[model samples]
Every structure is written in C-alpha cells, then in structure tokens.
Target chain A: MKDSSVAQRTVFFISDRTGITAETLGLSLISQFEGIPFIHVTLPFVDSAEKARETTQRINQAYQQDGAQPLVFATIVDPEIRSLLEKCDGFYIDFFKTFIPGLENELKMASANVMGRIHGVGDSNVYNTRIEAVNYALNYDDGARTNGYDTADVILVGVSRCGKTPTSLYLAMQFGIRAANYPITEEDLHSTQLPKALRPYQHKLFGLTIDPKRLHAIRSSRRPNSQYAQLAQCENEVKTVEAMFHQENIPYLSSTNLSIEELATKLMVISGIERRLR
Target chain B: MKDSSVAQRTVFFISDRTGITAETLGLSLISQFEGIPFIHVTLPFVDSAEKARETTQRINQAYQQDGAQPLVFATIVDPEIRSLLEKCDGFYIDFFKTFIPGLENELKMASANVMGRIHGVGDSNVYNTRIEAVNYALNYDDGARTNGYDTADVILVGVSRCGKTPTSLYLAMQFGIRAANYPITEEDLHSTQLPKALRPYQHKLFGLTIDPKRLHAIRSSRRPNSQYAQLAQCENEVKTVEAMFHQENIPYLSSTNLSIEELATKLMVISGIERRLR
Candidate 1:
C-alpha cells in the first residue's frame, strides 16, 4: 500500500479562461484534506489544442516526478480542447462537462459552449456596474466625502484601523454594492449621540468594532508609539463606539476575528441590502 | 410537453458561509443555458438545522408556485445540515459531496468537514497578506506615489480610464499581488521613451491600452465634452501609448473587451507572476 500520509501529490487547476472558477472550487475541495500537502499548478487560457497539449505534458511530467497520478481539475468549455486534455495521464475532473449536460437538459436548450464567458467581460453592463461601484467605494472611503452618503448602499462606521476600508472595497468589488466608510473620530467617540453627518443616513449605517489588542497592533505598524496606537486608547474607542451602536440602535458586528468576506456577508444580511449586480 | 422557452424557474445558491462559491459556480453553470429565465436566490450562513429547514421551505414554495422543481446548488460542509438540505423539494446538487469522496480516496484521509473553513479567516497569514496588498494597491494607485514601485509585484502603466485601477485592486484582492498603476499623462503620451519615474522599473511594467472609441465614451461619462474626452484626443493618446509599448518592449494588453479578471490573469501569465495566496 502507498504511504498515503507522507506522499506528496501535484494538483493542476486548468481552465479555458482565467481558471478562477476552477481554482476557487478546487482550492475549497483540496483544503478539506488537511494533512496532505499539494503542489498546485495553474494553466489558464488553455483554450486551444496547442495549449492543451502543453498543459498535458506538464501534468505528465509532474506525475513522473512524483511517481503518482496527478489530480487535474479542469473547467474548459470547449469540447475539442477538453477532449485533448482527457488523453493526459492525470486523474481528470471536468467541472463543466459534469454539470453542463444536466443544465442543458433542464432548460431544454444547448449549452453556449462559450469560452471565457464566466470571467470575461461577456456583459458590458454588469462589468461597468462593478467598476462604478469600485470608484464609489474609493471616493467615499474613510469619510473622505460625507456628501456622497445618500448614494451609498451601506455606510460602514467604525474607528480607525478597525477594518472598515477593506470591508467597504470588498462589498463594492465583490457584490457591486456602493459602500462608504466613515471613521468614528475620537471627538465623536467621546459623545453618546450619533455624528451629525451620519444621523441622516442612520438606516444605512453598520458598525464595526475590533478588539483592543488587535487594533493596537494594526495601528502600531502604521504609526508606532503614538497615543492613537496605545492600548488604552484603542480600548476606549472600541468601547465607546460599540456603546453608540447599541444606543443608536445601529446594527453592528466585530471584525476582530472575521475575514472581510465574512464581515461583508454579515453586513449584507444585517442591513437587508440586496446586491445590485451579480 | 412543457413549454421550455418561456417558463420561469427559481434557483437557490445555499451555503454555510457567504454562499459566494455556490453563487459563482451556479451562475457560471446556468449562464450556459442562455434563454432560460432564472430567479436567483442566495441563502448564506445556513449553518443550523433551523435555517436549513427554512430554506427548504422556501425552495418547496418556489416549486409549488412554478409547478417545477427549483435548482439548488449548495456547498455546505456539515454533513447533518447537508443531509437535511438533500430532503428539500428541488434539484439538489451538492458541490462538496460529489468531489469529497474522490479526494478522500486519493489522500487516504478523512475530510475535515469544517463549516466556513473555505471562505472564513482560517489562515491569518493569508488574510493579512491580501489586506496589506489591497492597501498597497490603493496607496500607489493612479500614480499617487512613485516611491513604492520597488515593492510592487507588477506596475501597470496606461492612459486614463483604460481600466488600470480595477485590475490593480482585483489582483491584490483575489491573488494577493501588490499592483500599482500609473496613468500615462498628456506629456508622457507625446514622447516615445518610457517615463523617467518608470525607467528604473521597466522589467516590472505592463501596459494597458483601450480602443479609442471606448476610451472616449468612458472619459465622456466622467468628464463630459472636455478636450480629454474628445474622440480625436483619445485616439491620439491611445496611438502614442501603443507605439511606446512597442518601442519599450514592455508587455501589454488591450483592456477594451476583457474583464478585470481576464486582464489580471493574462498579466500573471505573461509576467509569470505566481499568486502569493490561494
């Protein structure tokens, strides 16, 4: 029997387009087998037969070197190129082939078989929507301009270094949501009422608070030994902002342990904000 | 026979986490059947039996109303919750179930079965790398600063509105690549040589050019009727920039028809920049 625990395997994520979908799903799948280490090779733009043959050779070489069959996860929409890849020595899994037929049958229509349609700019309207949202996020970031709050789908309120900027950009880039973030300044933190700028758009406000230690560490890296980066200052700001969220009845969450994805998702759920584009 | 051309169907993307993976893969799969109208519903954070039951009810209600089963694409990790979803009145496609067994057999190990592990902040190092990269992209965006060019993974040089900002941010957000962009100015377009600021980092530079008509339209939206938005001026700038790219031998691509995902992927392939994070 092969030594399953110690043997290292090579995995390939090949696709006709950017390979993003293949890599994303493949990464999530491989992450499950925690102990095994995987050497990943991504072959994107494998749309033609020539590129397919080249990738096949690479996969074979990996198999020969490792003395094991490499696992290949492919998401090619082109049948000709995909069939060429099937001749390779690796254990091939075609994401498109497995599901496209079911979908075609269900819809009583033929699959488009269009390459790069998923990640490419297939729909100009959708593409422009995302670009505009990204611009909106940057323009309104960190309360850079409070006048644009009326157009924001969601306004993130929190102290500096509490993870508002990244969350705002993530919402915009990923979901085409117009997100504006305002830093809860020390002056505002000392009071109980909501800031004058944020009071009008109170319905769009979502509060983010971070742990004092984490906030201090994040701030110290940017500006070391400053009073703003002190642990006591961080603690006071977090405490006051969280209390303001409670008193003002603003929906809030902690970003101390959550990734931007989790934080954005939580904000979307809490605010009942529907995504503008998919 | 059922009328396939006009009937509307509902599709649900259910997951224990953000439902992003499910939605992404499902949208790509369904986009193949072009004519079918699908009402998309995303149910994220369905980690509990109660939530699963509620989603099941929603799915069944859709089925009852449409007189057709809704299509459910799920990526839940917990077996108990997934099994409960399997009983829903819809066409159940379990993303994890279909692939986990094959992976387990290959690795000779048990799957972790961890909910939210894929999209969650499971690895703090990976999370921080992306956040830092995003900050780097913003700080160096649009030639905002010239000092950080040495630290960038790739520096994008292009004319204004040729799609550099989004591509830079997408690189940082998706692949943890530190990308900085510089907008080619009126003066830089008049000359053949690379800009003095970009001279030291010629090896790290990639050019982006867009179709002149598209460029004019894009600029016109931001600044109407200005000389910068004129068709002739856009044509002149694009021609000059393309000529400069040829002379400098800096790798370049047209962003006119490509999405940000496609642009970033092509840049990675041409520049041989491996992703820093998965």
Candidate 2:
C-alpha cells in the first residue's frame, strides 16, 4: 500500500507556550502541498536556552535519519531562544518575528513582546465568559431543559444524530456563544410543525439535516439492529424534518459533508449571532 | 472609561472558506500589540470575484472611517483573488501566498493551491474519529458511567467543579482524544487511598487541582450560601485530594490560571498521549 514515489518530510511546531497557534498556522500552510507526507513533532514549552539547544539537536537527528532538512515552524517570542532555533540544521520559519515589524510600523507603537500572551489566561473576563458558555451548552443540551431557551444565543434543531450536540458545544467552546440543541423527535416530524417549546424562539433557530444514508450509518453504530437505526426510519425522519424547516422559513444546512468548524462558522454567519469572546 | 492613550484600529479576516486559520493566526499576531484596541470583522465563504470586490470596498470604507488603513489578514488561495485583496486600502498580510513558494521549492512539486482544504472534510475517518471522541467525552462526563473507562485514552480525576469537564471536552473536540473525567466525591476524598475503580488504571490517570479560593468562588456562583461553597470546606477538600494525588504518585497540574487549551496541551504532553488526528 505504500507509495514510494511520494516524498516524506519531518516538521516541527515550536512555541514558548502551548503550541496550538503554531501548529494550527503551520498545518494550514503545509496543507497546500498535497503530494508530500509530513511527520509532525510539536515542541511546546521550549522557553529555556538549554531546551532550545536540545531541540536543535533533535532536528539535526531528524535530518540525518530522513536525508532531508526538517522544516521548523516556530512561534517563539524570546529573542535569544528564537535566534538559537534559527541556527538549527533545518529550514526555520519564524511566525512571530516575521509579522511583528509590519504591525509595529502600522500601529505606530512597539509590541509588548510578552511570552505566553496569546494562548495564556489573558483577560479574566473573557476566560470566565468562555467557561460560562461551556456550562450553558452542557446544561441546555438535547432539549434537556426547555425553560432556559430564552437565554440561548442560538437554538439548533434537527433530527436525532443530525450533528447538533457537537456543533452546539463547538459554538460555545470556540466562540463563547450560548448554543442549545433540540432534537426533533419522530412525533414532531410527523406533526409538520415546530415543537411547542421552540415556537417562541423562532428567531434564534437554525436547522441541521443530514443524508439518510449517513444518518443510518451513524444511528446503526449507536443502536445496531434497532428500529431507530433502520434506513427507512432515517429517511422518513430526515424528509419530514427538512420539510418542516423549509415551511417554517428556518435557515439550514447539510451537516453531511461539513466539519464542526465549518458548520459552526456557517451557522453563526447565517443566523447573525455575535460571538461573546474572541 | 475608554483609555485615550490606546490607539484604535479595524482588522479584517478574509478567507474563501471558514476563515478560522486566518482569524486565529491574525489574533495571535495582533495580541502582541497591546496598546491598540482592534475591532475585528470576519468575511468568510468569499469564493467569488464579486465578493472579493465587495470586500475591497468594505475595507476602503473602514479606512475612510478610521482615517487609517485597516490590517487585513487573508488566506485566499486563488491567485486572482489574492492579488485583488492586495490592492485593498489596508496593510495586507497574505498568510497563504507569502509562504507557498518556500514550501514548493522544498517539496519540489507544485502546490495544490486548493481552497478550503485545510479545514474541510478531507478524510472521513478523521472526522468520524473526532465525532466519536466527542460522544465518548459526553457519555463519560462527571463519572456518569465508569464501565467505559477501560476504553478511554485518559481519565481526568478532580474535585467537583475543578475544571475536569471542559478540559476533557476540549481534548476530545480539538485533538480527537477519547477523554473521560471523574469527580472525586467527598466520600472518596475522606479515604486515604485511590478510589476502588481507579486502582486498576493508575497509569491512565491525570489529576487536575485548583486553588481553594478560586474553587470556592466557582462553586458559590453555582450554589450560593451552601456548605459546599464555603472557603473552609474548599480548602479541606483540596488539601485532601492533593495529598491523595501525591501519595498515589499521579501526574497533575494546576488549572487555576490556565485556559482550557493550555490545560489540555500540558496534560497531553505530560501524559504522553498522542493525538489521533492532525
């Protein structure tokens, strides 16, 4: 199964704090080169000079093993450590220093150059807001509590296994949006109308639907051989719920092919929901 | 209450897809410039020439209002659209094009130049893995069910409201790790040994502890004027659980001043848990 024609490379994500920002940006950059397979190593909390030197040796060892210079994507804030990493036997891309100058010149002020500020616990209020949103999502998940619908920033509605719970949690955790999801049961699907609990929050509603075949597979994994997992049952539920969404004028999307990030972002845009935290 | 010494600027995150990568990298880049207050606007799903032109006029209008060129962070992959954005009235930072050439030269292949590939549903197996992880986290949350702990990658043990749930969810959602959390009840804390259920899985345990004062505040917010929220009660419980962690020789970290991302990353590193997906 191996493709010998394809190339292989070693990549590192280096940072002083959590290497999330570095990894995310680096992954996005390398995703463009589809023909090469990258083996990733993340070096987080590389703050001290000794750690930087050790990381340089590791990169060198990787180069020796692979017969190619490893690619290093770094977000180190300390100038001394940053320079040491730059001297390593690899192709180094400095994510921080490369863009700081343009921002400094445009803003007419110097950067604080503080380490661990990006992913650290900055602005206690924002941190608390995010935690609160996560708690809200859990408390209001899957129509467990309809009394709290008024406080929700957006309410997601769909049939069972239509990808509502994960999307709600993603909205809350990533953006501090208080999202609640309500599953459209078979009874509600047959009624051809919105559920009574959700009728009052029509303005805050967004719908999600999935292909019947995908729904069948997802449900079969959860409850194999049950009536709920039958393909005909899934088809009926999806068809009825989609009809309800269309008749009620609710904006919706297919969750069949979209990732949670794409679904959350698209839902926020379509519903005009403002994120409470950045 | 606005500080007159702080400068004001408008920033734009423009992308053909979800714009999450552009926004995250742009935010990290701007967080360094602490003296400026930025107003952020994200234009996602701009996949056509008309939308690009409209975005240009919008950026121009922002410049006219602020009397300064806005900072635009873009990840548009189309050469024509990328060039169009370059002509906008802003300090444009092309996140994709700026780094593509170096990657192309190193890989010795033409860049795929694909739009929406980074955050899109590239592989069904990875997507399903993340969804399955999310479901596992929810199912095993708060010691809801311990029968499935044998299948978990990591079991987070902590006191009530000690930030076990959010960290577990983040580990699952962000990195596709099947994380399960157990809240150490008062009965378990009074005992001098590990819980009966956790004895067999000592190697999979990771402890989370928080400062008593902070825990008291968080608990009070949930149930005010209760014995559980008293400072003395929090102090005793924290001391006991921390002693238990020490006696058991379990790896642990403080969640007091750490964000979810930071906590999850540190835990993953200390526990040596490999991420299932990149």
Candidate 3:
C-alpha cells in the first residue's frame, strides 16, 4: 500500500572523490526523518567548478519540479567549488563549511584541503596492518593453518555455513584481530568432542550456531536436495553444537539474526578483544 | 615545535547500540577542522532513561572540567531519554532532533525508534551474500581455486605482498563481489607470460603493483636479511609485473599510497563493477 501522505524530497550527496562520507552522513541525517521518502542522488567526482555548476543546476531543477526545497549534503574540499555549490537553491548543509572554520581557528592554520582522505586512505602503516590482518585471517581460515593457532587471537568453531569465515574476516578487517575459523564437521558433532587441534587453543575458542531454519535455507541454496541441506540435519547439527558448547564449558553465540558487524562486536565484548581502529 | 595555540576538546559519541553510525558521522564532521585535537569518548548501551541521565551528568561534568563546551554527537532514539540528555551544557548536535520531527510531519507515521539496526546488521539475504562472497574470495585466493575463475566477477593478479588478497577480500566484504586473486611469482614474471590458468580469464584479470621502496620495506619486515627482502629483488619484481601488465594489455592500478577502500573503489570504476550497497 502506497502512503500518499508521505512527502518525497530530493537529496544530493556531492563530493570531490567517492561520495561515501557525504552519503553516509547524509543518509544517516535523513534516516532520522522517518515519515518522509527521500530520493537520493550521489554526484561523485565533483572536483571541478563545472561539475559543481551542473550539480547546482540539478538541485535547483529538483526543487522547482518537486515544489519543495531539496536538501544538499556536500563535502567539497575546494573552496571555489564549494562556493559554487553553495549558490544552489535548496537547504544547503555544507559539512565542510560547518566545521572547517572552527578547526582552522583552533589550529590557527589552513587545512591541506585534501579530498577523500577521511576513511579513504591515510598512513600506510595502519593500512598495512589491516591488510595483514586480512591476509592472516585468510591464511588461517577453516583450520587451514593449525600450526598458526598460537598466533591467533580468536578461533571460531561452528558448523558449515554458520558464518565463521565472514565473522572472522570482519574481525580482521575492522579490528586488526588475527582470527581463524574451524568448521565443526559431522564427525566432530557425532563424536561430541572438540577437535584435537582445537583443544590446545580452547582459551581462544568462540562458537557460532545458527537457527536450523536459517541454516537450512543457506545450505539448501548451495547444495539443494542433499542431506547436508536437509532441515533435519541442520536441527541435529545445531542441537549437537549447542550441547557440545555446554558440555565443554565453551562460550558461544547464535549467528542467527545478527549482522557480521554486530556479531564481531559481541564477540569482542565477550572475549575482551580490543578493536584495532581508534 | 608543538603548536601551543591548539585547542583540545572532549567529543562524545552516544548511541543505544554500537556507536558506529554516531562515531562515523562525528569523526567525519571533526575531520574537517585541522588544528583542533579531539579527545573521543564513545558511550554505547545507553538504552535506559537512568543511563541517559548519567550520560547527561557526565557531559556536563566534562564541559565544566574542560572549560570548553564539549561536542556531544548523539543518536539516542528514545524521545524522553534524548530530551533528558539535551539538558546538558555542551555543544549538542542531536542527530535525531535535527531531522526527526520534519520526517514525522512528512511521513505522517511514527518511527519504530529501534536501537542498533543502523549499520549494525540487517537483511539476512544481503548479509549472506557478503558472507558467501568472503568465502568465495578466501577459496579463490592466490590462485587456490583458479577453476572457480568462471564464477568470479573480477580476478586480481599481482606479485607476492602487493595486496591482492586484502583488496579482493575488501571487495567481497563491502561490495558482495565474487573476487579471486592470484599471485604472480618470479617464474611468471621472468617468463613474461600469463599463467595458463589465467589465460582463460584474461578479461577479468586486473594487475596490482606496489612501489619497490615500499615493497622492500614490507618484505624486509617479514623476512629480514633474505634475498626476497633485498631491495634489488623488490625492484625487479615490480618492474617485471608492470611490463607484463602493459604487454598483456591488462587493466592495473598501483597498490601504493592507496588504502584497500580506495583500491576497491578505483578497481570498481575501472572494471565497472556495481556496488551491492545502496
């Protein structure tokens, strides 16, 4: 059912480089307004005054056509280009203008006016640490490198498709944590014992289990009409894994209904692993 | 010489769940100012009104102590709790207040006022795609699954430690791309030929080469006093990789002075890979 009461306003995210920052902040700001529908337009690579002028024209046209003022969220680094954008006929929120003068006053110096450096890329060493963590996560994935267990900060154990790999990788990418994952296969579940390789790293163990229905859905998509994807098999595996976690006194978390980012954060809180990024 | 004129202010990122949205938006806003040094405090899990009062008290205390109005960037969803925190003495930028009422008027509907959904986790299917892509990237890393190249949307080729794996993983995690990366060895570089395994996937191949100096520094850290870490070897490998890329007419980008995010964006532009996220 269409909500005829909702007002649809045009919103622009203009940036000199990829408009990720502008869009992230702009969308977040707009998300607060729940009842209104926003039509988003991202004008990336808007470094030149010509592009700014064109964007200004588009903003004005949207305002004219919509019979409402459009909202402009811009982070243009160039002063001349930002000034050009400021002339647009809309409710302008120049993120750059709002904060730069205050910062300049505090520092008593001019900013380099670099484009796309915020969350873009800065400090090769920090960048390398993140990349190295990713590489470590990749190499240590799925019990591929049992010998590297001592170096791992955390080792996730769960059934196939329980999201060990993604959670491990996210921990690595976002937190610079060296995470390794080991899949709990059918044999391990039947045996009701932690794998010998994992026993040594028990202190580092964190378990993930998904709801049987969600597990079945995920597995059936990959291997349909097979026993591995059977709902019965999923239910059995999850029950067994949860039992094993209880029997072995290992802490665990349900992978169901949790985003990888959220799962990572929860794991960090539980395991006391600090985030790599400040 | 230290800048004595610089001002330092306490900045708060308050949210009911993980403070990612508030922190990301707050940091980007703070990044615009050059000379001010920010002391960041992230107070998450403030879901209760009592906690909100405590937070307000803390904010007021910080303002009094610092003798400068602290910057309070918040995303508290509860109206009463937000109203409570708004009583604090500080430079408050209530993200919820700036847009919610206008949104309420436009949509003519009430927001769920849910906590932790923004940037925390949502949509099981989309989340699964990212997990599936990460698994795919891990499986195909370093020519491990060249047979799976047919399924890959992009294949990255580069000398060892030139950042093929991390770039591929980032693409998968952030964009839900089925990315595979293959390492170009000295043999492949010296022979000046793309490996037979890669020839069939020529259209998908993208090369990465790092600056020899930076590569030397990275390699030396990993394997000190080794032939691989020698500056001469680093120079030779980069030269060979660049030549092979030019001769083979493969699209390429430098892995130097670029963050994984930037590299991913440039690769998307060059290969025309659409981002899965809106």
At residue B25, give the lDDT of candidate 3. 68
Candidate ordering by DockQ (highest first): 2, 1, 3
Question: What's the C-alpha lDDT at position B163 in model 1?
Answer: 95
Docking class of 3: acceptable
TM-score of each: 0.97, 0.98, 0.86
Q: What lDDT tens digits, residue by residue, belong to model 3 across residues B88-178? A: 8867776666656665554456666766655655666777678778888878988887787888999999989888888888899887998
Candidate 2 deviant stretches above 4 angstroms: A1-3, B1-6
lDDT over C-alpha atoms for residue A6 of model 2: 66
Q: Which runs of model 1 end up more than 4 angstroms from their true locations?
A: A1-5, B1-5
C-alpha DockQ for predicted model 1: 0.81
Q: Taking chain A of candidate 1, what TM-score results?
A: 0.95
What does the lDDT read for residue A132 in candidate 1? Answer: 96
Q: Extract clashing residue pairs from model 3.
A: A35-B107, A107-B35
Clashing pairs in 1: none
Instruction: Write model 1 residue lDDT over A17-123, tens digit each, in one string.
Output: 88888887888888888876689989899988999999999999988888778889989998899999999999899988988888778767899888877787877
lDDT of 1: 0.90
Candidate ranking under TM-score, highest first, comes to 2, 1, 3
